[model samples]
Structures are given as C-alpha cells and as structure tokens.
Target chain A: MREVILKTTQLSKRYGNFTALDNADMTVYRGDIYGLIGRNGAGKTTVMKIVTGLTEQSSGEYEIFGKTGKAAENEKRKIGCLIENPAFFGNLTAYQNLRYYCYQKGITDLKQIEEALKLVQLSDVGNKKFRKFSLGMKQRLGIAFAVMDNPDLIILDEPINGLDPIGISELRDTFRRLNAERGITIVISSHILSELYAVATRFLIIDNGKVLKEVTKQELDLECSRCIVLKTNDTKRAATLIENKLNISDYKVIDSGEIRIYDESAKPDEIGRTLIQNDVTVSGIFESGVSLEDYFKQLVGEAQS
Target chain B: MINIIRSDFYRIFRGIAVYIAIGIMLLAIGVSIYMIQPGYIGNASVGDINNENFKTSNYDEVMSEYTLDELRAMSLSDYRQVMLKVTGYELDRDILGTNINLYYVFIFAAALAVTVDFSGSSIKNTLTSAISRRKYFLSKLIFVNLMCLIFLFANTYIMYFANIIFNTKQFSSDISEITKITVMQIPPVLALAAVLTGIAFITRKTAVFNTVAIPLIMVFQLILNIVAAALSVQEEYLHYELQLMLAKLANNPTESYMINAYLICGGIIVLFYTAGWLSFRKAEIK
Candidate 1:
C-alpha cells in the first residue's frame, strides 16, 4: 500500500485538430517502476512532458505529491525527468553538462557531478565533449542527469533508445539499483517492451493517445502464461507444416531456427513429429512461457484491430 | 535564480560566442586603428584637388596641407572644432557608397546570443531543471545583456587602445558628447537583442531563422530609420540623433548614466521574458 506520488485524471493535450493525448489517467506509486509502453507516436512522451510541467495540457488535471494546480511548480522539485531526446549542451563535456544541471537545481553537492558520471560508467570521459559521444553514451548521460538530483520520482521517455544490448542491460541494472537501493519511484516510457519488462514493476500500455491498460507485474505474469514454442532447423518448413498439418494457422517463424505458435495447447512434440514426418529437421522442441514481446504484440494487436 | 544565471553564464561562455565576441572586438579595433592612421587614408586619397572621383580629396587636401606640427597645434588648441568638422564632413560622392551602415557588430553579437539557445538545445534542458520558465527566461536575458555589454565595452576600449598604440591620432576628449552618443545607442541594441531573442524563442532554430532574420532585420531597421526621420518626431522628442535614443523615451536624459539605459533595457527584457515565458510555457518541446 505505497502512497501515490503522481496521479493524473483525464489529462488531455491537443494540437489544433490533432489530439496528442486524450483524457489519459495514470498513477505512479512510491517505490514502483511504472513502464509506459507505446509505439513512436503513442503519446508516451506527451504524458511525461505534461506531468513534468515541460508542457501544458489542454484539459484535465494532475496532482504531484498531493499538490494540484496548473502552477504548482514546487512539487516538481521532487521529480526528475528526461523527455524525448536527451537535451543537453552539445559543446559541454559530460561532467560539465551534469554540473550545469546540478547548478540549475541548486544542489550544492559538488561530488554529485562525479557520482553522476560514475553512475553512468562515463568517468573515463572526463574531458570529452558530448557531441563526440555515441548515441548510447548520450542516452546514458541523459539518464545520469535525470537521476543525479536523487529526486523521489524519475520519469524517462525512451530510455533505451539507440542503446546496444550491453548498454541496455547496464541501464536496466542501474534502474533496479536506483529503485531498490534509493527507494526512488521510476516511470519509464520506451518502445522496447522486453527491456521495459526487464526493469519495470508495473505497465501502462497506451495507443493512439489513450491508455489501453495499466497492469502490474503480477497481472502481466498472469497474462504472459504458457506460450507454445517450436524450435526446428527447417523453420519455414516447420512453420508450413504446423499451419497445414497441425492446422494452427497463426504462427511466426522467427530467426533462423525458431517457430512460435501462439496457442499454448499446441505441444512442441506434436509439431516435432509433424516436422519429422514432413521431412523437416526437428532440432529442438519445447513449451515456453509467453515473453513480454508476445504479450505486447497480443495487447497491441487486440487494441489495433 | 542565481543558479540559473551561473549555469547560463557557463553555457554561453563555453560556446563559439566567446570566439565571435572576441573576434568582433579585435576586428573593430583593427579597423579603427587602420582608419585613424596618419597615412592610411592615402591609399583611398588622391593628390589631385579637382578630382571629383577621389573619395577623401577634401580631407586629403586638409591633411596634405597641414604638417604634423600644425595638426598637433590644431589638436591642442581647437580639438573640439577640428573633430566636429572632420567627423561632420561629407565624404566625396564617389567614395561614399549608396548606404552607410552602423551597428553591424552589435546586430551580429545579438543574433548569435539569441540563436545559441536553439543551436545548443540548452534552453529546453534548462527549463526542465526545476527552474520556472520565467526565471529561465530572465537568466537568459541577463546573459544576453551581459554579452552585449561586454562587446560594447570591448569594441570601445579596443578602438581607443588600438589608435593609441598603432596610430598617432589624438583620442577625442569630448566626454559629454561621447557619453551621450554611447548612452543613446544602448537602448536600441538592447531592444534589437530582445526582439531577436523573442524570434528565436518562437522559431527555435538558429540556422534557419538567423539566415532569414539578419537581412530582414537590416531592411526593417533601415526602413524604420527612414520613416522615423521623415516623421520628424525623432528630432523633436526622441534622440534619433544618437543611436540609443531611437528606442528611448522622449523624457530620457542625455548623460552617460546607466540608470536610464538600465530602465529601458529592463523594460525590454521584461517584455521579452514575458513573451518567451508564455510561448515556452505553452510549447510542446518536441
């Protein structure tokens, strides 16, 4: 029964005839990693920006730390946000950029600059300019700047964008560390559903400027129950045999040697026998649980169609 | 507020603006020195008295006739009269181009300052850092004003020092006139900067807006000057006779005291900040 740090009621934003965010409702509880899942233009960034006061909503209301007002700016002091692309001084070094933000927040802890850089694992880039950093490094730097203040609520939009697997894993671990070690509530918006599931404790799926569902980790686990997985060397042949012989039509042959059947009852042994009898190479067979990617496609497809 | 100012100052001083401002000041001093040199004008001057094509023939006649001693004597005895006549004298029609321009450096510096925010994306980051839009805009305005002041002072002092070091020209001692002229120019510089800052706040792209704005502003200022001159109100109330007077009120003082300049600049800053705050507070920041 953690307290709610942020709550929005029917918050809407419009740009002329285009509604960017439509009567969206969300709540970020204390010590929670709330995942905001959406496509490129699904209004995730708009929601984060509105809550952070970087943008004004056309209608509806939001409360931050129990404070409700259009000009309730003081509550923002407890929140840190990195919206959209990482905005920073390009000519400044990572350290200098962090220091600039620290100064702006009136945080006199000079050691925070070093700590921020260290947290991002960019301590070696002491004097290198930000423009020279890779896209992954820039994304990490954006996160570092956001979290350096040690604010109670941290909101990140597209945090894993342009990040490699290693960098993505590193940031995921950092998010967990921040939440568990520091008791900071995190609200992250990202298109990477798998990574979001890896670090987030709750999910807020949005589409076409509206929230489709707000599910917790327990709900997501419940929804992501057993999914049929069939691995075979002859993926195309296996997929064709599964659709034609097994009559499980909706299936996807991913990568070089993997076929996934959405139906949980479609046993891999039956698929393996069908593949073997059909002259397809039966390399591996198993029943796997549903991954976040599968769950996301299911959720998004259900809404989209 | 102090934090915003400090951060803004660092952001500004670390960019290309430092080089540009220094470059402008150095170039101004270099040009002023060249212009004030004893024989530098000879390159453009002709010895022929009746040569109508010669741009500085009249000034050349005055200079060629007077020896160093005579010039020194005139400078010591009737410096004000000599300077007034020399400064007021119209150049030969051939040497005088179609237009005489002033405040190119000021416009350049102001435009650079206004565009820095867009080119760097620091404005967005700054506003999101627990600082209100109003305070952020104020800090930026203060940073711009400080940049302008530095350039203005640098240009003035560089010109003075360069003339003393390289050229043998006697620096004028007309403090009241110089002060009036300097004071009169400050308001418009501030206003021009404010206007450009507003445009940058609205457009949020330096390369595009500045490319279009620089020439457009030049033309607008030219037209405004002509219209103001034609209206004849400048001569009556506004001190269009000087640079700063164009943006100042009719009841403004002519002295070099910075209070009036500060007031005018402060008002313009408030207007710009208000506009910028409104625009930014509503902007999507996409």
Candidate 2:
C-alpha cells in the first residue's frame, strides 16, 4: 500500500453562528497530486488551513504522515503550504523573505531559494521588494516559498488565482514535474475544475462544508470519457459479436447490462445491427459523457440546493 | 524557536523601522544633552533654590543668560560656583532618572517587528510552514523582550556616558548611582514589553497597537491621578503609576518600595506573557 501522506476524518470547523467545515473526510497517499475542488467558501481552504496548522479544527481529528496531534505537528515540518494569501514582509525582497523562512525551517544552504524561484519563473524578480510585485508575481513567489523547502507534501489554496494563462500553464508543468521527478506529494485546491483535471491524479470535491465525492484519475477519466454506451443482458454473446463483427476492443463491461465502447471506430448503427442480428436485445444505446466542469457544478449545485 | 528568532532579526535588520527608531533615540539623546536644564527637571529639589542670592537675584535671569552649555564651558570651579549661587544646592537623584521613556521606543519597535506580521498577514507564511503556533508565540515574546532589554541598556548607557562627557562631573552623578537607577527600571520596562506583546496578539493590528502604545503610560498615570484626587487622598494612588514609579526610582526609592515594585511587575510579566500566549494559541489566521 502507498504511504498515506494526509488523512482527515470527520474534521470540522465552526465560527460562531456559521459552520465553515462539517464532518469532512479526505485522504491523500504519497506521490499523489490530490486536487481539492470546491467553489468559494466551500471549505477547501478551511481543510488546507486545518491540516497546515494555520487554524485549529473545531472538532474531529486529522493525521499527517501517520501521526496525530502533537506528533502530527512535528510532522508538519515536512509539509509546505500557501493558504489564503501570499503574505510576506512588504519591504523585503522575495529572496530575502524565502531566506528568512529558510532560517526558520533550519535550512543551511540558500541555493534552494534560487532554484525554487527559478521553478516558479520568478528568478529575475527575486531581488524586487514584495510590495512592488504584481499580483501574478506575488502568486509565483508564494508558490516558490511553498516548494523551496523540498517538502514531502504541499498544500496550496487557490494558488493560481491571479496567474495569467502562460504563468498558469508553466506552473502546471512545474507541479507535474515536481510530482513526477522529485516524488513530492501535493494537494492543490481550485474552483477551476478544468485546470485541476489537467494535473490531479486524485480528486476530492467538497461544497457547503461537506465532502461530496472522491475519485481517482482513472475513475474520473472513465466517467468523463466520450463513448457509446450499450445496455444488454446477454453479456457473453454480445461480447463475442462485438469483437468478431465490430472489431472494437476498447471497451469496459460495467455490469451485466452495460458495456461501454471507448473507440470512435465503433459506429452505433453497425453495433446495433450486429447485436440485433445475433438475437441479443439492445435495450438502450446512445452517446454519454460529461465535462469536469459540469460534473463539479452538479455536485456543488446539488449541495447548495 | 531560535531559528524563528534568527529569521525575525534578519527581517528586522533589513527593514527601516529599527534604524528609524534608533535615529529618533539618538536625536533625543543629542537634544537631551543640551536642551535639558535645571528648569526642565520640575523636581521638588528645584524648590530649594533661594531667590535672593547675589548673581542669581532673578532666578530666571541667570538661567536665560548662561545656558548650561555656556556654564559648562567655564572652568570647573567657576561652573560649580555659579550653579551653587543660582540653585542654592547641588545635583541630586533627579538627573539620574530611570530609562522609562526608552520603553516607548521599545513599544514602537515591537509594533513594527512583531505586530506587523499579524497586520501584514506574513504570520500565515510562518505559522503555516515554519513552526507551530506555540513556538511562534514563544519566539516573538522572547524576541520582543530581548530586543527591548538590549536597546534599553544600550540607550541608557549611551545617554549616561554622553551626560558625563558633555555636562561636566559636577552635573553628572556617579556611575554607580546611574547604574542602580537603570537596573531598577528593568522590572517596569520588561513588564511593559510583555504587556505590549500581549496587546499585539490580542488586537493583532498595527493601528490598534499604536493607538494604545503611544499614550499608554500617560493614560495610566492620568487615571491614577484622577482616582487619587477624586477620592480626596492627596494623590497617594499615583505612586503605583508607571511614570510615577519611574520618577520615584530615579530619586533613590526606599528598599521596601523597590521590592514591592519588583513583585508587582513580576506578576504583570507573568500575567501578560501567559495571556498573550493563550490568546495567540488558537487564533484563526485569515
């Protein structure tokens, strides 16, 4: 089994008359680019804050790196985070600010700061004061700070909120590269499902302070993949006919009455004729697919409604 | 915690606030070296100046005609003779005053160094990654007090030596007495540091800290004076005030009074430190 990097069980947070997070549960395994998809004020940042120790959970518990409570706190040194905003001393340069954190985190060498800035495409402006930075620059610096420590796990909240398209694409590649090359596990949150779908290996969708769904990349791909779905009870005969007559092998048999063909070469009319000729009742047949955005809205909209 | 402190200092030195604070202090020291005269002291000892003596017939005339600078420019014996004729007494415990005013500098510096983190939201970066809330609070508390003490001693000794070099031996008191008064001011100064740090955590805003810090001691003394006066007790309650304690400490306070002040300040330090930490322990960083 893969190592569990972060696991939250029934974690909740409340502020006075409002509930920010309610009995939310999530788990991220090592080397997984876990994407937390939620709309604004949907408890995505709340979960990140609680796990990163920016705020305490009102109830329930969470474990990081297989440890809970105080031990979990000690384990936090191996994690990096950028929650809510990129807060740094305005007067200090980006390099100076990261160097300060390097000291705080007990990092002896400073070259890592340069490499982090370079990864975020911020090396040219590393000497510029933070207050003088543009919003996109600030976001890049925040990302740099989160990755500079070479942490085991990274938790980022709306990290691409202000980046332009090119910056976003570059950072996406950076995250993917870090996860692939360095084996750094990351849990990134965003309301933009399309952007997240491009990078995340696993997903957790939350809305209205509750977790709505969790799905792996393969499951999401299968759900979202465009295909022709056929319903038939005679699974044995239908499979033989489809292979021999239709020459469509890119398919998955979901159950006794459903078989989905992923290859575009399998025409609906040909499959229907072939199945009917073989005395296999084709009860239902049509194209079926859903975009990631539609699916996220459906989940969040259902919760809101 | 030490790492946090190291980073904090790194940030501080790179900023302009600490240097500006030091500049203001040095300017105040320079101005204080010359502008402060017997007339500015306002101590009860000034009441001892007999108005009828020759060469000081008009008490205001001699002070206005010869500034302390001009008087000190004269030979030592000549300077002492003129001062004895004008005030009818020598320098007393008043000139070697407590460094209570230095506490204000520390407050402003603490506001910049420590409180700015909360106001600017940079605290999120630190607490979210570098350390736990407990260590954050501890490092800040220790940093504020340690920085305060360092500035406090450095300013006091600088002003102490400056006073001796420029004002002549007759005007400057003994080094041992000046050291005693400076040491005696510690409990109160450190107590103020803890209280300011507590206020920073509780309020978590620069404007609020400044609004409270700028007028803190004066307000405390004013309230004490009002209570003492309203109760028809001849201002007895004013003795516990921060400025009042400062004024008293410089004037050779009694041993029992020193002990009582130490105990009270000790209680204040503990109360504020624990209160600041507890208040900060669970604060939701937004």
Best by DockQ: 2
Give the Å error, residue B165, model 2. Answer: 2.7
Please give, for residues B216-262, the per-residue lDDT of candidate 1 as tens digits: 54465466667877986543323332232332321234455345555
Model 1: per-residue Cα lDDT at residue A238: 73
Tens-place lDDT digits, model 2, residues B1-286? 8998898888899988888888866766665555333222222322232121223234465567787688768764565455544442113234334345566678766787678998999898888774878788888888998888887777767776776676656446667876777778888878888888988888788998889877776676566566667888754344555555666666657888888878888888899888888888888887
What candidate 2 gets wrong by more than 4 Å, as runs, is A228-285, B38-98, B233-236
TM-score of 1: 0.74
Query: For model 2, what is the error of residue B16's alpha carbon versus the real structure, in angstroms, after optimal superposition?
Result: 1.1
Error of 1 at A104 (Å): 2.0
iRMS, all models: 1.8, 1.2
Per-residue accuracy of model 2 over A1-305 as CA lDDT, tens digit each:
89998999999999997999999999999999999998899899999989888889999999999999988988888888888888888999989989989999899989999999899878888467999999889998898998887899988889898889998899899999999999999999999989999999999999889999999999888878899999999887888888888888888888999998899878888899889988999998999887988877777778778
Chain B alone, model 1: TM-score?
0.61
The parts of candidate 1 lying over 4 Å away from their true place are A227-291, B37-114, B174-181, B225-278
For every candidate, how close is chain A to the native chain A in TM-score? Answer: 0.78, 0.85
